[model samples]
Target: MDKVGETVLEIDLEALAHNYNYLKSKLLPKTKFLAVVKAFAYGSDMVAIAKKMESLGVDYFAVAYVREGVLLREAGIVTPILVLHPQPVNFEQLITYQLEPSLYSPKILVEFLKTAREKKLKNYPVHIKFNTGLNRLGFWETDVDYISKQLDNRDEIKITAILSHLAASEDPDEKEFSDTQIKIFKKISVALNERLGYSPFRHMLNTSGIINYPEAQFEMVRSGIGLYGYGNSAIEDKNLKPVAQLKTIISQIHKIEPGETVGYNRAFSSEGYRTTATLPLGHADGIGRQYGNGKGYVHIKGKKAPIIGNVCMDMIMVDVTEIDCVEGDEVLVFGQDNSADAFASSAQTISYEILTAISQRIKRIIR
Candidate 1:
């Protein structure tokens, strides 16, 4: 794509497809692929990503909430959607949209069953989430009996899948913990299957799990960041391409004399003759305050222009003294060349946070 004239996020559908195919290649033929498109597809366009993945024949799509699922359904997405953290208040809407819920607690399970029965539904699909080690949102291993008793004779809902989250599949030091989580998940799955008189499809692998622990890939695997680019490791990242490239044009140029302040609170006082460029995106645009005061930098004309002031609500000033750049020159905030991972690392954060933090107001140019 050419230089972006304004602050925009370029979504490369081809890159997305490449990442999807690469990750899919690691799975067994029968292992279902569930693309986690939650958080607006990690701050990219969710509907667009889902449409692409669906066209790629993904078996399932997971979203964080019922409304996200509703959006996909409204967009004519026919694939099965699993809501990872559904609320009881929206259980009716979830059922209306034919979105499955991950029932992690007894209260949620009972509430959803009540709603399912109220709708006069039969065998409505729902996933049971077990807290193997994540300890976030899921039932304990001992909850298997409770879940089975709750659904013993009820035809309102059916446990179609059992799921769990890995706390640190990306960290090599957490291998033992991840293994324990997987073991616990297997034990829980066995107990639940025996109690339910049938085996629900099991899945407990995220993007990194698919890369590091393919042996534990039970029946299905879910990936979010992997689809968007960063593979949680330098090695795996080379195999996948980033789908979003954030770019903007320099709004203005400034010649700062020595000791002159650059932005709010006099955060950056020029030490020497400096040339700076103002960008039209800041905290409001997802470039947070933490990236300000020379911590983060933007790539301009193949050179690094370090941000030199407190990131404002709608703008940021970068020291462009060494670059041969003028006003309106396209700047690379993060992209295939600079990489969101490297940019985020400057602020001591991860690529996932930076990518998802991108504001929805930015124009998304789909390539």
Candidate 2:
């Protein structure tokens, strides 16, 4: 708890470990845990988060791209890395870095196979991604036979795992859709395994799925938000702890007269003489404009300082007329006192958007 500085993302490794163990406790005895460290570990420090997870004996690590996996490798992480949405163009880099790529299409499978062969690869590990319900990425269920056939012809590539993304695993109320997804995923697994004459590890659970559908836990579970301390489900959300807290310092204080405006667009007009504190954070740092114009607030000391006016690229103003604040007071953008969930509510968004939307350039202080 050092003095809060400008635009710093404080990561509590202890809290992260606590969250990891808590989620691990919920898993079945045979299920393995895979930490998703993609998007710079969800806009926190990836290298530090991955190292911490590795120390805790996480089964594997997943990233969104080949470069992300390469970053972990370059940092000396020996743990197996899964590239979730790898492209055909990066197959050579993936192979060269010994990173596993998630093959989601026939073209991707065929291209990666060629690259693997050219690199003299034998049983080169690759995960097959089936689009169960997300509809965002991965191959369709109808493409399962084609995928199996392609793998059958390509001996250079080893089918490491068959995985799918849950469309709504966090919302237990949406049990029907989640159950349907699980059923489809299981069917795909069975069909692929039968066709290939062997079974690869099957994983379909994200943070939400792991909590709501314990019965759906396959050989491995990929957790992205949960690892970062959010289950996004009512039941699971209660137990998990947040891993990041966006903290910044109050740079200046302004006392505006009645009718005066603040920030860009004159979005916030002072109703009366009021005090405002400008913090060293803005949309560029991931606090989007959606939080502007009294829509959001930052925690000053222990009180809520409502946001005022438009969010600039490098700064934002908060109405601190009532708070006993100063120029150098610590501002809690989103943390234990003012949870990301609370801040997101102000903008009619979710914790995921608030967390992942954070910019990468901000300084990360790991505790």
Candidate 3:
């Protein structure tokens, strides 16, 4: 716990395992689960998180880029890696590491096929991403026929799975929108299978999709946020548990008199005499500046301390006038008492953004 800095991110592998098993229980017997480890496992120590997930017999692992896949491969992760958004430039490295690429466009598919053939590979496993609604990256439904025609000519590449991203699976209120996405994905999958002459494993449901539409759990399910303990499931599913805890220590104390301005730009003024605790963390460590001026808080000695003034790059002040805390006292930035969910709510964001935005510079202490 005492290794590098005052501010550290505590990662509980036990909680992670609990969350993993909880999600596993929701899957059908024949369904496969792919753990999404992209963005450094939601910015909570990728190697450690992947190692823990791998040890728990995670069926598959997913990363957003080829470099992420390579990192896992270098870390001795032999699990099937699905590169969610791979580039053609990394084709050789991906192929060398036995990494599977998600072919989202005809250009990517053609380039990947060319690379596979040049490498003298056969039936190489690759996932086909269809753009049902997300419209981020994927082959459009209208482009399916063209893709199938190209695949027919190229015998080197094999379509291992057909997948898609759900746009509004998290919004329980948007039932019709979610339903439309699911239906479109299903239609695309059917058409793709018929055109390809073989039915590969089809997976469209991400964590939210798996939670909201269980019947749409084709052959596999990809879980990202849920595996780390935030379920997008429309209904309240008490199965998932949060795995990361952001903690810091009060490094110093300051007493401000009435009419005194605090921090840079004089963003916050003390109306009365108040004691403030200077925590050794700030915007540089994922505590955004938006949290300043009493908008955000931290738990000091189990009491809420409102953040004061403008957040600095490496430090932030919290009004702890009522709390009996001193220098070096542990402060809960986001955890048991103040969950990441709650913190996100206060910051006007979601848990995913909060988790993924945590900078890599912060010390990650794995438990």
Best by lDDT: 1
Against the true structure, what is each candidate's TM-score?
0.99, 0.97, 0.96
Better of 1 and 3 by lDDT: 1
lDDT of 2 by residue, 152-198 (tens): 76679889898998887767577999899889998888888889888
Model 3, range 311-347, lDDT digits (tens) per residue? 9999999999999978888888886567787777776
268 Cα displacement, candidate 1 (Å): 0.7
Clashing pairs in 2: none
Task: For candidate 1, give the lDDT of residue 77.
Answer: 99
Q: Rank the candidates by lDDT, best first.
A: 1, 2, 3
Give model 1's TM-score versus the native structure.
Answer: 0.99
* Candidate 1 lDDT by residue in tens digits, 223-329: 99999998999999899899999999999999999989989999998889999899999999999999999899999989899998899999999988889999989
The count of residue-pair clashes in candidate 1 stands at 0
| Candidate 2 wrongly placed segments (more than 4 Å) | none
Reference-based lDDT, each prediction: 0.93, 0.87, 0.86
Clashing pairs in 3: none
> In candidate 1, what residue range of length 10 has the lowest lDDT sum?
1-10
Candidate 1 lDDT score relative to the true structure: 0.93
Kindly report which residue stretches of model 3 are placed more than 4 angstroms away from their true locations once superposed: 1-5, 233-238
